[model samples]
Target: MNPLGPGDPLRLGPYRLVAVLGDGGMGRVYLGRDGTGRAAAVKVLRRELAYDQNMAQRFVREAQVAQAVTSMGVARVLGAWYEGSWPWMATEFLAGPTLDQHIEEYGPFDDLGVRELGAALARALQDIHAAGLVHRDLKPSNIVMTSSGPRIIDFGIARPEHGLTLTLTGQIPVTPGYGAPEQVLGHRVGPPADVFSLGAVLVYAASGERAYDGGHVATVQYEVVHGEPNLSEVPEPIRVLVAPCLAKDPAHRPIPAQIAAACATSSGTKPSAKKIWQLGELAADIKQREAAAKQLISVPDVRTPSAPSRRRLITALAAGGGTVLAAGGGGLAWWLLSKDGGQGEARKPSEEESTAPPKPWDAKRLTASQYEDGTTPPSLWGPQEGPSPVVVQPLPVRDLVLVHDGGSTTLGAYNVIDGKRKWGTDVGSYARYVAPSDELVVTVGPVTVGRTGRLLALDSATGEKKWTAPADAVHVIAADAESVYFTARRDWRQSDVSLLGAFDMASRTTRWTVPMPVECTLVTPPEAATDSGRLVLCGQNGKVVALDTHTGKQVWTLPRQAVAILPIAPAVSKGIVYLGGKSLTARKLQSGEEIWSLPAKSEFKKTYGGWGAPVLDGDALYALDGEEISRRDRRDGKADWTRSLGDVLQQLDPPVVQGKTVWANVHSLDSGGIAVLHKDTGKPAWTYARDGSGGWGMAASGNRVFLVHGGKLTAMPVF
Candidate 1:
């Protein structure tokens, strides 16, 4: 606490200000008291900002935002002045230090302290989100260590523009490490964004270091978006838990309840307001301050401020989402949503309003997000039935993506850079194929709901539904700038036969659909067969076939040996189709003529439960076979080179080619790790291993390697 400065207020309404509690970008917090001697922490907005309509609007919404947060796991609001010369509000005084202060005073906490802290904070977040609020800034300073428990102070009530504010010293008013990628880009801020921060908070408590320490705001923001968080110093249980919370894709992070359960136990008693007072020398100092404050004020005179009870929220927000707030003693109500993706509404600055083109799609980020299946929540408009569970995975961006509420049960486009939402609709629980023109297909029915399958087309840019088609688990196989080709089972529940079709992306009208001659069970949509883009696709119909993408007419077909039942997606390069499961086969792309078939009995354990696709690199093809990476000839299926992993390898995931190297995830005996190899000679270049399980994955972008396996997308630096 600091002494009152020259411009400080002595009194505001019924409270007498004493000392400065803290300072922030928008306002100053003071230790104050009512006439009855009850102490309160009051916040006074900056005089200049109080007059600005935008600032005033945000300031007034504090009452509403605060009301949304339940009194559990946080300091309670005692009084508020909605209309005063200097807008001010008071909350219960917490007699303790902040997480930041405690960490600085003592050293870093042990694993037990970290776990307890995580539990308390996760519960706080659970209550906040239950109130339909996202605690945008959830850092150490915002958490006060009280005797009862850690109190989450200062809920994100102030909504500054794009979360970018220039301070008196020209530094930004935010901590970049605690903010997620979407927060930096000014995309949608959701509960998952808070979870990402939670991961950072846990890292700090355990190791006394920011996970992404770039020093400055710009560098930190860049690191949050591109670089992986360094968690080497973090030990086992905590490291394992913190990793998923910091996933690049929000969907992969476990929910708060899950977090609480996972980090449930603590060797020490849970952190509370009483703990600090009992253990440390500061107890005397805190007592002295409490007595001094009480001596200055009299007792038992004024009426206590009674906050209104939480009833049903009635305000309709801008994104057409349900917004139920108290509205400042029911003072004012407003709503927000992102045009690309987020809970907040899109509000561009004045200068770029007329000329800003659509935000570009971050292809790498999009590809990374594709594997996440973010199931929607029960409410998009307000808090969910049970603490209003929200699933804001696949964050959106402006003009380029469609935002959806966290766990929104809808089809939405999200921007890769900031997780801003473009548009969203009730298309279904999952999205399928992405077309060239930014239109994607999603499934309408899920088996859990016991509903038949149907397909819907949505504008990825707008989140608007274009058309609907009845189909059985349709999977996109091939796509171009104008159309999308797909394959589906004739009867999803019973038949092994399938059909192929072509549909114009814009109109969503089927050009044609044809039945397959062979009744194979496994299949995928059409793919480009030749270098010039002739349509070729594979199916368990026991064959690789070529079709005219425009007409859906089969050009040629070559059956796989009738013995192989499960066929993997074909890998096409030059003019060959490489598809197999327990067996490997090469066929002509244009005519579907057999080139070669590697028998199933070869010394390769490529498939475990599912077939592994071949990795194509110029002329050589690679596949994970048991304990080695085998490089085969693209033309004659002849062996080029093989590098034995020396230990039993996990099932192979699709491989990725970068320059002259190939990268993938593998498992050996007691560990899971990633390995990089020379594409031509099949010699090892680099490898990194840990104790956890890993999938064999193969996507790369920028300086990072993207792996999609086990239903998760992970980004790790090549280094």
Candidate 2:
């Protein structure tokens, strides 16, 4: 069964074995050729490991998750399948070497190379963590050096902790020296644990030594638990950063994103004057020395001094010098003449050239006047007509505010920063949902007539009534600068059906309504109207429908399964819609086509199902499920970073990012408190606790954050 021996069949599956790359605790890895003759390193599970059901399941799951993560720095998972009794996973076979092998053959890396390696590994960890899986086993042996950069391999043991436990009584099996204390104790393990391992790996890679210098496993574990790491060789700037990553308590450890940012800041090389001067001088010296050496080596004869010979040499030298001088003068003249023959010539600027004045600052500062009018309007009011609320709610605007208090309806102009009372009218009691638009706020409630709901339009500023209508089922409301759309559902004796309808804001007319094939929930509005003049809608049943806003015609429909859907409103940035649930997907608004999708962490499969829509900012989409918030690329759904906020209080508010900080209203499960985070690094900025009480439903603006509790609002500064 060994593929490395001579005369044995080198090919397995689509790859041909070339040589034994190495052997590890799991099995032997073979260098092999693919169907196209490209090289790959395939790790085949040992028979002992493969036969163990638990280990095999973990291996297969790791392979599945590893394949879902897409990053050039991480070794690409090419294929995984059973070949006899062994299961194997193949990755791009790099020709360089393992970090371990490199260190063994060449000692430790230089400071610059070590920092570069740290940054690359940190980035790779970011990608892996973003996919919701932890590289539980990160060491020098798992990192492969390549021409491009480091490639992280061996996800055979990586696993999500969603439904899994760290240890059963004392069955801890992780590498003793690299494992965090919580991991050692077999308690809960999260991304922080992986960060601890990464810190140990970096230390080993930089110093060519283990974090602990003990001889016994117990001694190493003791050192890891109680002793400071031997980081004498690590650069000063990185020492402080890596220290936190090795914290014994997972809660005290820095997240992978923070580690990466720190590594980036420390490792960014800048050219210096001394280095530049040295390089220039070295180049000049090398050129002069080479010329002198070449002349000496090329000459074949040497002559002793003689009067007649010297005179003849002098005469010959004088004639040669005159010829050389004339040629140089003529070439210079010709170059000068050629400059004037160009199509156009630029004139020198005058000494008194006027410089443009500095451009005016465009960013608006937060003014006290914005929040000074602390007057609270009554819950019920008639329309009075004024300017609508400004349309800025992060980006990829999703969600409209509509309130059905009892049956008496109140329509509010909703935005990320402010929500204003637009209008209030007596509809009925027992309202369920409210959907908002620039000009109208629709209030819906369940009724006997197939879950009937009511829709109303009001003057955005004055709260004056515009028009009203009855709807079947109301789940969401989407709007542009000019019009509004809503999704409604109707239930028959045995089946439930859904519909999407659009209404003109100026005319107060039902523009159109189209029936849906199945009962579905609306994710968000399209980023732009399609060529067919219709808005796009994603349903809960995984169908994307484009319906004409002016007519009841179906423009196009496609099948898609998303855990979450967030519509991008026109008032915000356009051309992109955010989706997250089980998996994250971004779609182009114009064509109802998927742009990209990223795998969501298994832990988020449940909590994120009920979390708010993903928030979009520029090209980044932010989504939080439970204690983790991930920033992903809006174009290709690639993860930029993932940060764990830790489990806090119940009924926690969503996270808001401002400047370099992320503010959130958290309630501690043990007690009531609030936790704040640095957005760029995911490190805890601060934590504030309310006396004897818990808070919920928080909102933030500028440097201040607000929390509503028992009919009272508490505002606190973030800094």
Please give, for residues 1-719, the per-residue lDDT of candidate 2 as tens digits. Answer: 11245433355689766544445666657656665656566777667777876766666556666676787767777777766666777775433345675554334443444556777788888887788877676767677555456667666566675535322235545777888777666666778877888888887766667876688888888887788888876656657767888877788887766766666563444312222112221222223323322322222222322222323322322221110100100010000011122123222111111121212311132343532222221211122222112211211112222333222232233332233433344542323222243344444433444445556555544545566666553543455433556666554232344566765555565666776643353323233232113365544444556554445456446554433333322111233445444455555433445557666454533223433346554345566655567666555656677776566432212366544445555555566555566555566656655443534444444334444443233344433
For each of the candidates, give the backbone clash count. Answer: 57, 20
Provide TM-scores for the models.
Answer: 0.38, 0.36
Error of 1 at 704 (Å): 66
Please tell me which predicted candidate would have the highest TM-score against the true structure.
Answer: 1
Number of the top-ranking candidate, with lDDT as the measure: 1
Off by over 4 Å in 2: 1-454, 470-476, 489-497, 517-560, 563-573, 604-612, 636-640, 648-655, 658-661, 664-675, 687-719
Model 1 lDDT per residue over 1-719, tens place: 33467788788878887655456666777767777777777777778877876666556565445654565677666666655568777776654556775554343554556776788889988887777666677788777655455667764352322333223355444468888887777666667888999999999877667899876777888899889998976767788889999988878888888898888755333233233333332343234233333432332211222411111111111112211111111111122223432334343211112122324432222232332222211111111111002311122222232322344245454333333444556543333344444345443433234444566665555656667766554554455554566556656564443676666545556666888544443322233333222466555444566764545567677665322333445676434567655566776544555678776433432224323567665446777655566777666678878777666544434566654456666666677666777666776766645344543434443323443333333334332
Cα shift from native, residue 220, model 1 (Å): 1.4
Q: Which ten residues in a row have the lowest lDDT in candidate 2?
A: 325-334
Quote model 1's TM-score: 0.38
